[model samples]
Target chain A: MIHDFLIYFLLIVLIYTIIVMSFNLAVGFTGLVNLGHMVFFGIGAYASALLALSGAPWYLAVPSSALIAALSGAIIAALTVRLKGDYFQIVTLGLVFIAVTLSRNWISLTRGALGLPGVPPIFKDSLHYMIFVMAVFALSVIFFYWLTNSGTGKIFQAIRDDETASSVLGKNTYFYKILSITISTFFAGLAGSLFVHYIKFVDPTIFDLEFFVLILSMLIAGGLASIQGSIAGVFTLGIFVELIRFIDRVPLLSTVLAQHPELIGASRTMVYSVIVIYLLIFRPRGIFGRVEV
Target chain B: MPSILPQLIINGLIAGSIYALAAAGFALVYYVLKFQYFSHGAIMSIAAYSFFAFLNLMGMNYLFSGALTVIISILATLLTNFLIYNPLRKRRATSNIKLIVSVVLLIFATALLQAIFGSSTKSITLGQNKVFDFGTFTITSIQLSIIIIAIIIFLALWFILKKTRLGKAMRALADNKEVAQVVGISPEKIYTYTFIIAGMVAAVGGILLGLEQNLYPRMGIPIIVKGFVSSVVGGLGSVPGSIIGGLFIGLAENIGVLYFPTGYKDIISFVIMLLFLLLRPQGILGVKARDS
Candidate 1:
């Protein structure tokens, strides 16, 4: 039972590692500060969950999650790629809020925030599911590592450092940016699908602003742009996020908390937000972050 | 069908007035510093909470709490700018870095507020709110006061911008910082004053919103988003443009309920924001040449 729980926790950490690593590709590597990247995650979760719930095979649902998310990411990139600085952030903010609204209001599609239930597990046995999740995690890490070493990776860094210089060097910066965002969001989708299947639940809250903050906290805390950092962030912050379930078990602080138990609900996010602020101020580069913005 | 136009119009104007107040504050900061002030939204919550504490905890009257909170909010905003943002600005950090810092401050403030105040929603004005009736539509006195006070503040700001020496200095700094400095206007001083004034207006907006709706830690994000959209959609640096943009958003969102579900009202503003960005990022009053 303990092993099963550990496996479940590790699977979650790995899934988020995939998601945040993808985020790092854009924010840390490509210099595209997409404030609305959660839209892709939402798309992945909704597409795969809906597909699986409607009796589509896992083979079709999972790939479609990646494909649909990537396509949507590409579309957003195409439309808003020209928006520089504040305008870019504003538009991305608009796009994602729209996605959230859709997820919330499209009751027939998303079940209207009440959340969907009884999502089928990929494998019946806990051990086999753990191995399956681990395989996917391995694949994601390998893919990101390969991406970091490829010529395209250098181009992405160049765009981040100086877009005009790279453009002057005859590199199609816009195309590379769109490509990076698409790839990043593809992995985000995969992560989202994994998340849904593991937890066996999906809801509009999955794409809420707090969820974005949680993922962002992980990316920043673990160190941006590095695979190791992504892993560290997912593991550490994922535990912090999951601690709400065991909030009562936390020692030393439990006495003060025993007085007002209602605070247990908001304490995790509160701590995460404070940590993010401190990290930004004191260690902007993060533990494993190689680049500074 | 019943004539819902008057009711909708009243709501729109009241909401728009509050948005305009906030947007105007936002524009004041953006015009000179040139970064989207991420903590601008939280200023409202800070003021609102302070207002609440002074009223309820300290046993102060509404007027005293309101004035005291506004002053406190302004000072806090100035402190943040002087301590955090100014040092970074001196280092010649990128706008992205400034943006991130502001965002962090915003998130931190919201979280800290929740931690200190607890998660429960708190209201400033106690008991049942009094509603005023027109011939066809009903409006609350508090809501009507928001519109009236908003118009008064707007005119006051316009007067300052048009006639006052400090406002002239501010405009000079915004127009061309180097030239303004050459003319002996201290950019740092202007920044300090602008942030304070911005905070004051934000406090007013906060008070209005708390009276209209309710107060909570996370209330600032959505309010801030609306203010930002209004500012950007109207014109980034233009003050009157913010008012127009705010009204437009308020009306559009209110009327959109006829076609869209109530939950999708904010969605409509976002769509409009996208349309404005793609088609006319300059906004209604913005100069085309300045857009790039």
Candidate 2:
């Protein structure tokens, strides 16, 4: 039983690590506050789920969903890159709502809030699936580490620090920004694909604000602009998010929680919010983060 | 379709008034602080719940609960400025950083509210609210009050901004902070006043919105989005523009339901905001260009 739980936990942590690292490319390195990252995740989940349900192979569904997300990411980036920073943030944030509304209202395609379940798995058993996900996670870490350390990563940071200065240096800042977002979203979509196959379900609730906040807290706490930070953030917040469940084991809190079950979710959000607020105020760079908020 | 058009317009006007009230406060803070005050909706949520507790739990009369809630809202806003925003400003944080902090605060507020009140929806009144019928359309008493009170508030705000000393100082600061400082206007003082005024107006908005609809922890998100849309549509930092933008969105969304599902009503406002941002970031009354 303990081994099974551990496997599930590790799988979740690995999945989150990929998503947060990709998210960091756009937000931490490129300095784009793209709150619409979840939209890509949702799109990937829905696409993969639909394809898998239609009897497509896991390999085919995963890549196809990721490609679809990447295409949308590039389009979104191209449309909004010209916006000033704050406007860009708000517009991207607005896209989350638009995407959620679309997913909910377009019932014929997505199944709406009813969700699409019973997605086919890549591996037969949890153990094999964990090993497969671990391989994917390792590859993602190596790829992200290489990208962030490369010359292109340097340009992303340069654009983030000052777009005009980078543009004056003759680099196409717009193209670079779009490139960063597209790549970031590709990975986000990939994570979503993996997540759906593992959970074997996809729903509009995947785009909940609570989940977004959870991912954001991970990014902030782990620190931005560092692969190490993203890993550290994923584990730290992921563990805490799961760890809070054990609060039910504590004698006093268990009774209170039993009486009011909803408090558990509420408390988790409160704790993360407090941690994030404190970090942003006093330690804007975050625990593992090099970039200041 | 034509028969329902008048009703939709009336409904739009009612919603517009509330959005205008909320947008005015949001725009006021944004104009002065030069950041998206994302917590404005959180403050609205807080005030709405406070009004709810006062009216329902404590069994206070309407006027008394409203008055008390306004004072509480003002204190809450002032405290947020003193505790959170003021410190960030002192550290010379960038607007993006502040915006991030505000978003976190918003999430915190929602979580805290949920923890205290639970996730269930609550309404101000228990039974069916009173309504009056016109020939073409029917109007609820609460909706009528919302419009009347909004017009009154707008007139009051116009008078204050145009005629009062405080309003002039606020305008001066928003126009050029350094120039206002050079002339002897204190920004700290104006910021405090801005928060207080914003808090008071937001309290009124919260009460009316709660009375018109149901109150839930997440209600703040959608309302704030609408208010943000209104502010963007009218002009980011312009007060009168927010009011106009609010009404326009309200009308558009309601009328848009004619062709789309009712669930898509919110998308109408969001689309308008995007169109405005892309095509004309300056908005109707805004003089500043988008590049800024």
Candidate 3:
């Protein structure tokens, strides 16, 4: 039973690692600060949930989810790509509000706030299923790591560092930005789809403020602009949250803090906030952070 | 049909006035700080709650409570800048780091307010709900007071910005921070004054909004968005632009409910904001090349 729980915990950590790495693609590599990155994840989860419920195969649902998110990313990029710095951040923030509003109000598709539950697992009651999911996640991480180290990755870094300089050097900064955003959102969607199947429940709240903060915390903690750092960051933070939940099961701690388990969740958030703050204060460059600014 | 249009317009104007007042402090901060202050929303909410607490618990009269709230808010605003923003600025933190810090502070402050206030909506029943009837229109006393207060505040702000030495220093700081420093003006002192002014104006707006509607812990969220949209739509650093943009949003939102569901009323402003960012990123009254 302990082993089973551990596997579940590790699986969750693995899934979040994928999600965080995908987010780092845009925020860390490109310095986009796309606050609405969770929209793609939420969209992917919703799309895959609906698709799977309608008898589509899991394999088909995953890629299709990425495709949908990529399309959305492209549209968003096209609309607000020209906005620089803080304006881009606010625009993305607005996108998050709009996405959540749509997810809540669009009753016909998202089932409103009721959420899509009982999503089918990938394989029937086998530990190997978890391994398979982990394998897929690992493969994607490798692919992303390779992608970020390639010539295209250097171009993205150049664009992020100085768009004007990159443009002066004959790089199409806008096109590269769009490409980076598209790729980032695509994997984020993929992770979302996988997450829905693993948890067997998906909701609009998954796209809310808490998730946004969590993704951001992971990216910041792991060291922005480093793929390996983001994965470590997500795993570390995800497991930390899970550990807090487990600790809440302890009779002594529970009795002392009897009135508020909400405090536990809040404490976890506070921990992340403190870590980010400490990082900013002590090592503003981050744990594995590469970019200077 | 014809008569109701006038009433709608009047209502829009009243609502728009509230937004304009709220956006003033936000605009001032943006103009001076050159970055978004997410905590502005929490501060507004805190001021509203403070006013409510004073009136309900301490038995203070409405006018006295308003003054107390404004004073407390200004002090808090000044302290927040000193404790949070100034330290970060002195370290020369990146804009993204500053933004994240602001957002974290917003969330933490919001949660703190929720813990203290228990997340309930607090209403101020001042017993001043009398309505005045004109030839073809009617208005509440509260609404009339809000309009008067907004005008008074706007004029005061205008006077301060135009005539006061501190206001001139603020303008110089806003124009060019490094240059202002070269001229021997301390950015820290100017920022402190700016924050105090912002807090005072926002608290006044919050008090009026609470009186007009009801005060809730979460009330500042929507107002913050509306104010930001208004600030952006008018021009980030332009006080007059924020007023015009805020009024435009108020009118558009009130009138938009006629065509769309009430649930999507907020979306109209956000969409307009998004469109503004896309098409004319400078805002309605902003200079074309402004970095906002």
Candidate 4:
């Protein structure tokens, strides 16, 4: 029983690890707040699900999800690149609101809030799915490591550190920003596809601010701009979330919380918010992040 | 078409008033502080539930419930600033950090509200059968009061800004903080007053919202977004701009469904906001683009 739970837990941790890593490339490396990260994730899930249901092979759907999200990232970047930081965040948020509204309202395509269930998994078994995710994680980690060491990565950091200086140095900062967003969004889409296929479901609820908050918390906790930190954040927060799911089962704690039984779902989130506050106050750079500013 | 049109217009006007109210507060805070208080929505939720508690739990009359609830909201806003924002400001936290903290506070606060209130929708009973019908448009007295009170508040706000010392201090702070401080205008005191005003305004919006639709702990999220959209469209931090933006959105959404499904409302709003942002980001009032 415990072994099964651990495997399930590991799968979740791996899924979030991919998301946080992908998100870090934009937020930590490129300095775009990208508040609407979930829009890309949702698009990828729907794209992968619909394509697979229409007889596309797993390989085709997987890469196509990345393509679609990349295209979306490019378009959003084109429209919003002129704006500075917080405005960009709000624009992305608006996009998320629109995307979620569509997902819920375009009932024929998305099945609305009822969600699309019974979608087939890529590997058929949970253990096999975990292995598949592990392989993907390894390849992504390797790609990030290479990218970070390469000159392109340094340019990314330069732009993040100071866009004006980067522009003065003759770099097309907008192009680089778009490139960073494209790459990050591509992986985010991949993560979404992986998540949907593994869970065999897709829904409007997948696009809420909580998911963004969770991913942000993970990146901040694990330390931004580092693959290891991404992994650590995923493992720590993933386990924390999973553990909190069972907090209601703890006899002593449940009794103390019995008066507010409805709060069980809220307690873990409350705790997470506190932790995020502490982290931002003490280590805004994150647990593993090296950036001072 | 005519039947739906009047209803839409009426709906738009009422909703616009509420959005304008929300924007008034949002603009005041964002103008001075320059960070998205993502928790603004959660604060609305707190005010909403506080109103609910007073009206339903304590069985207070409408007037007393409304007044006490606004007071609770003001105190809550002050506490948040004192404990969270003030400390962060003291350290000169980056805009991004302050924004993140607000988001964290939003998450924690919304969850806390849920834990306390339970996640069901609550309503304020106004003893119905009093809705007045006008062939094409119908409105309840409470909603009428909402519009009336909203206009009154807007007028009061304009008066305060144009005439009061605190208001002058705030405009100065919003205009240029360092210079304002140098000229014997204490930014902290002005900001505190601005927050109080913002809180009171948000409470009115929340109370009206509770009366109009049902009240849910998370209802503030959408309300805040619309409020924010209005503020941004009007150009962030501009008082008149926020009101215009709010009314524009209210009208836009209602009028939009004539050509599209109601679900497209969010899309229409965002597209309008995007157009404003990409084109006249300084706002319709054409305030010098604060940040290029």
Best-fitting candidate, scored by lDDT: 2
Candidate 4, after superposition: displacement of residue A101 in Å?
Answer: 0.5
The digit string of per-residue lDDT tens for model 2 on A1-293 reads 99999999999999999899999999999998898998998889999999999999998999999998999999999999889736787789889989888888889998788999889889989889999989999999999989988999999999988899999999999999999999999999999999999999988899987788778878888888988998998898788878777766778888998898888887777777776776667777777777765
C-alpha RMSD by candidate, in order: 2.9, 2.1, 2.8, 1.9
Docking class of 2: medium
- In candidate 2, what are the lDDT values of residues B1-292, reduced to their tens digit? 7999999999999999999988888888888778888788888889899999998999998889999999988998898899888888888777766777777777778888898998999988734568798889999877888899989988888887889999999999988899999999999999999999888888888888898889898877778778888998998878899899999999999999899999888888889989988888877676474332
TM-score of each: 0.91, 0.95, 0.92, 0.96
Local accuracy by lDDT, each model? 0.82, 0.87, 0.80, 0.83
Off by over 4 Å in 4: A249-252
Misplaced by over 4 Å in model 1 are: A1-5, A221-225, A232-252, B56-59, B86-93, B126-131, B175-183, B287-292
Give the per-residue lDDT digits (tens) of candidate 4, residues A109-145.
9989998887778987788889999899889999988
DockQ of each: 0.46, 0.56, 0.36, 0.61
Question: What does the interface RMSD come to for each candidate?
Answer: 3.2, 2.3, 2.8, 2.3
Preferred candidate (DockQ higher): 2 or 3: 2
Q: lDDT per residue, candidate 1, A1-293, as tens digits? A: 88877887888787888889999999888888888888888789888899899998888889899899999999999998888557877788677768878888888888887878888878878678778878998988998999977999989999988899999999999899999999999998988887888788998778667678778878877776687888888887788777666765689768867886776666655566656655566666667988765
Q: Please give the ranking of all candidate structures by lDDT, highest first, separated by commas.
A: 2, 4, 1, 3
- Top candidate on DockQ is 4
How close to the true structure is residue B126 of candidate 1, measured as C-alpha lDDT? Answer: 49
